[model samples]
Target: MFTTRPGRPPSWRRALVTGGAGFLGSHLCTRLLDAGTEVDCLDDLTTGRPGNVEHLAARPGFRFLHLDITDPCAPDAVTGPYDLVLHLAGPGAPADCRRRPLKSLDAAGLGTRTALGLADRDGARFLLVSSAEACDGRGDDGPPRSPWDDGHGDTADAPDPIGPLHTYAEAARFAEALVTAHAGARASNAGIVRLYPSYGPRMRTDDGRTLSTLIHHALAGAPLTVPGDGSRPLSVCYADDTAEGILLVAASRSVRPVDIGADPEPTVAEVARAVLGLTGSHAPLEFTDAPERRSGGPFDGRPDGRGPDTGFARELYGWVPKVSWREGLARTVTAVSGCPGPAPATTAGHGTGRWLP
Candidate 1:
């Protein structure tokens, strides 16, 4: 169970996690429960599998509700006076977003609105789990120092119009705007967290994110596909660290968007090689042609000095990612390779199969 550190006091008692059956969401649920908080997990299972949370079903203070936050009756279905509400519902996988653009948009737009409304009604502190994509298109340079950092004295560039490649990014940007507006109205105490590429256990093999795809390819002894030049840098946080960063923000009084990710950012090719090394797979690296628009360029990946500054989080909540990428990737490889086949239909007194639409 989570215990109070020397300076931090217990902040959450009851919590609700939207998208709580998915990879990062499931980790968040586990962490909250470990902190001795009663948790109600809401998920539609569109991309989240029940097996992810089957272990938690028997936990005394944990309950999982199979429902989409965007549904009209969702708020009524899960009545709550939760002390904290974490909005993590949304399609973040590139392929999933490309195939179900509307669903992705609705999840960020309508889903966030619904979550915000629920938090407002319950007077709960709200946390919006946004993405690094939200800061996309701001400029070719890099993300601003902080979400609150509007370039000092420098004229801000005109905002780019949403386009095909930016569907998910645009949706997240919209969600941030909505959250900002809601906070301005004092609807509820709320904060926005922009997550970089996060990877760990329970990541879907077909999710279309690079790290998971690389690991899956290594496991199957298939070619690891690296789109374009493979120079796009990514700073990935383990699921546990990402969840902890979110909780730090939730427990704090700050509402500004703090970036949650680790540094020494590795290139796509570097990550592929790491996976191969870890799994001892001889999978060949295949560089595929990608649309020019989709070919992301290199990024500044320094931990504390350059790129998006995480100092705000450190000073405010004393948060910094503990797990190194090498270690985290190894753990992920073990978990994925050892994952059991489709779990039994029933386990821990709750359904483990896919929830119906």
Candidate 2:
């Protein structure tokens, strides 16, 4: 049974999550429930597994509708206009996007448009979850940055329309634009959060994201694999931390971009080492200069410290990440290692398999 945190208790009656059964989306649903919000989960079970939300199926106030944002059906046609719509249903991992670039593009572009249309028609607030990749290749724009980067981190001497390092990055940019345009027109408030590397429970084990790669290796007591020089620094945010930021934007009146990440940037190598430490694994880490894993270039991995530094997050809404990296990782380790059980048989349309922790 999900319980509430200590407080007067926020009572947001109607909330909608686009990718409710995905890694981050599930957590968002949990957080919303804790805040006393009735959540409607919309997912088509494409990348999202039904098991991710099976636990919440019994919640009196929770409703799960199988609908893909990229291609919405009648059920997902907004049964009741939501008070707030948190759209987190795009391709987040690079590999996932690469595997199905078209679907990813559709989700980021058309999916965003659909969500915005729903919000506009319902007169609901919208909060789109963007990525730090939207900032620049370096992960963030930087504390002292150039205003001309267009948040996608302009490559040195690169052309004016900086080509995206990956299709997913481009899709996020498009989605943000879609949301922003809709917000300016209809919604009372809207904002986009450019999240850096976020790690926590519910992430799929097989996903090609860095944290998942490390955790899987550690779990198997195998050598952790490092791609390229392992010099790329990522502004990793804990899942709960990112969720808190998302919640803040959802409840806030301000409509702008917010960079959600942690300080003391950790290199990719450091991330692997941290996961090993958290897992109590003494396995050796094998660093390989895999060309496929190499960062596109200096511009691809640049980190920009923009967003929340402007005090937009705090000034508009009382939002702060309560969990530190170490604490967040510890919790993640526990959740990933200790689980409900093994997942059941999964098929494309069967919807029986649970999502990875």
Candidate 3:
């Protein structure tokens, strides 16, 4: 359990969220602030955009740090006696990893080490925001399962930690191992939450992922690009729900990895059609012969995973994704279609103590 107040939700006095300017990281930061937590959001801004969290700059309890976790000085920069430390820093989107393969490796390897060190110093409850891709590497055909494998007491063989895995999946496997080892060796309070695809507002439509790509073209009144006839099954959790599930795992004492994602398995074409309908775009679904490699799932190395059964989370923590795809997608459409976010007059950057607009 975390610190509790009379009327406010259970919260931490101060917390650190690495990759806070990122899509999911920003949501977690916002949710924490709403529950009365003083937040220090740290990001290198490599793939993360400052504009994502710039709106929170004026909030009294919020501070943004522009620092790379892999930097040796990064830990000292975040002088937090934090009660919660979330390691969400990494090249998460498929497009990001494909373009920045080496960066992806460091974010998981060195980045995880740096974040864990910060948490150990503060004795905070540490949570690594990982992806299901770390376990499910079936390319583009199969839906993603949780690392726990239905919690049937048996899990599939994890990707070889050595090699042969894609850049992102291999890095994820390495990060999870590092967290487990940290927990045993240092007695650090740590956990991992393996997320499936999570799409919603603040999600970059230009990421070249299936959902983002479809949304991007739909918003632009262009054809919704479909690869290989678009029959592969995929599912995504709403960003808010994913954030909440992550917080649940963070607040718990269990160090075991938990999966946080949706439960639907709609085909790719269905999802694209939904995007078109939501955007009110008359664009047709343009099927492409995007060549997919044997090992990589999609042509762009994007994995099309089936949704995992969230019963484990429901049983362990009373957590379940509340947003339906229709609703989640509609909300995403509204936000991406130029919905205004919080606009702070002036905000300060904690990393450099500089004034930001």
Candidate 4:
């Protein structure tokens, strides 16, 4: 297991999260605050919405700053002499990554460099929230799926071409390399936590992410369209679980790559059904032929569905997910359905970042 740095949470024990106002980032902010650590949330509001963090707006220890990670002034704008920097400002979905390839690439690579530079300058620990996309896309193709088995043998009828499409994976790989190089150059303590598909409240219904899209479609009583056979196996993590894992690694000195996700991959159809059940929308099901398959879609870009090994689990900060997929889905359904009104409004002047929604 990786050890915590000596004299950790140093003078500037505050945490600066580059995308602190987004779905996952907001959750991370909550965790840090609950632990009594002051958190500075920086977001450009590109996808980070104010609603995701409305409850946290008034908290004394939480400060939100609207800015882009790619901006040179990001470090100055946040006023960070931070003890830790969690870089979660990259693209959120495959579609967006595909549609805005340049932005995605820049954010994943240059953005990472800037964040790590801030960490190095401030002498703070850095944790990069990476994607499982770096596993090389296109994992043995047979059929396209939502959650295909990562370790199935040939003739399994499941397809996972294990190569990333476009520059998304390349940028991720580049970012990882940058971190490793920077750490080695300065002997800095930096690491990466590669996350798989995760879903929960605060996810934008409008974004093209499958999880949110399915939930939105179900709630709207619209046809729940399965892109393919829906037999593709998928592993999803609850946002809270992902946040916990991130904290575990960020706080620990785990410098190696660690895979964090839920096991026993669920099929795309199952996810659709789950959403329908949760929302009580009884949405009709539909399947469309996905002819233009990306080189490396979700099914083939991640580690096998097998659980992490003991050594890896320990080295990744002894972190394990607490919430199950079913429980998480139920909780999210309730929360969204019970939303008092529209999500919280993005505020300014209090150091809160820009408002996207």
lDDT of 2 at 44: 67
- What is candidate 2's lDDT per residue for 279-352, written digit by digit as tens? 99999988776443224322222234332352455555555566776677788888888543323322233222
Please give each candidate's TM-score.
0.83, 0.79, 0.84, 0.79
lDDT of 4 at 133: 48
By the lDDT metric, which is better: model 3 or model 4?
3
> Which TM-score value belongs to model 3?
0.84
Model 1 poorest ten-residue lDDT run: 343-352
Clashes of 1: 0
Model 1 lDDT tens row, 1-357: 233562243446789999898888999899888878989898877777788998998898888887777877788777777888999887766666776788888988999999999988888888988776445222236544433245674434323445555665567778888898989987469888877777788876666566877887898999998877887666778888888888888876567787777764778888899999989999899998743433432222321223345666677777788888888888898888866433222111223223332
Q: How accurate is candidate 4 locally (lDDT)?
A: 0.68
User: Cα miss at 126, model 3 (Å)?
Assistant: 0.5
Candidate 1 Cα errors over 4 Å, as ranges: 1-11, 136-162, 227-232, 287-307, 340-357
In angstroms, the error of model 4 at 182 is 0.7
**Model 4 CA lDDT for position 229:** 88
Which candidate tops TM-score?
3
lDDT of each: 0.73, 0.66, 0.76, 0.68
For model 1 the local lDDT of residue 136 reads 28
* Residue 18 local lDDT, model 1: 93
